[model samples]
Target: MTSTSDLWTIRPAQARDTDILADIYLRVRRTTFLWVDPGKFHSEDFVGQTPGERVFVCEDRNGTIAGFMTLWEPDDFIHMLYILPEFQGRGAGKALLAALPEWPNRRYRLKCLVKNTRAIAFYRSLGFAIIGDGSSPEGDYKDMQLSGN
Candidate 1:
């Protein structure tokens, strides 16, 4: 497996990927939630949450999981979009989002902790617009939506 930025592949996650996905989830969360208590970062709940969502993983040409995105398709909401810190800014996140099934005239939404400026900028770069604000266990969050064309 030899993947350049453009050569990475996206595919539906498999049962075998649960552990890696959970690890990625936790790692990314911990990095993004630095403002929160470190103890609050380790949770097994993410593994349970994976079964109910539509998860897609991006794999490097070497077959390594570089990132993943989980969406609650029926609700038109993206639950998470996490790329390994090393993989960030390399186009993996955009590739994952672009692979989502297109829905004509239907918008997709997600929330990012207001403190996660990097994520906010990344989402904004991808056309997601800030629509509102709210609070979460981690802290203040901003609701963002991407309009369906």
Candidate 2:
């Protein structure tokens, strides 16, 4: 599905977008996950995480990519959502989430690292609630779910 707003255009990711997407993924993870070893993140990690997932890219009015989100549709799981630091509060992330094909009508799930308070707050503001908690190699994370209203 594709969606456009004054600030962002969200569309299905294309093969040509992979490189920039990977770069954003690597950079965002390294900076956002301060508790993790930044050295362990690589562009290849984006490739590995995205296979079999439905991916979408968010671009600005200038056509510059601001972020991307990957969804495991079968489970309504939002596997990843990362906006560049510069684009974080400009509604790119919200646009990407709304672009989901089943958005607002189906439940969605995602895990946010507990220490990533900023992200957790963002999710919470969108009606997500912690359903569980677990530890991953990166750190402890909260399993959050946003149910259809």
Give all candidates' CA lDDT scores.
0.84, 0.93
**Candidate 2, which ten residues in sequence have the lowest lDDT sum?**
98-107
User: How many clashes (backbone atoms < 3 Å, residues ≥3 apart in a chain or on different chains) does model 2 have?
Assistant: 0
In candidate 1, what are the lDDT values of residues 10-126, reduced to their tens digit? 888888998888899888888878898767866575777666798889998898999999989888888989999999988898888877777324578999999999999988877
Best-matching candidate per TM-score: 2
For every model shown, what is its TM-score relative to the native structure? 0.90, 0.97
RMSD in Å for candidate 1, one decimal? 3.0
Off by over 4 Å in 2: none
Per-residue alpha-carbon lDDT of candidate 2 for residues 1-149, written as tens digits (9 for 90 to 100): 67999889999999999999999999999999988899999989999988999999999999999999999998999999999999999999999998987677778999999999999999999989899999999999999999678
Q: List runs of model 1 lying over 4 Å from the truth.
A: 1-5, 103-106
The deviation in Å at residue 21 for candidate 1 is 0.6
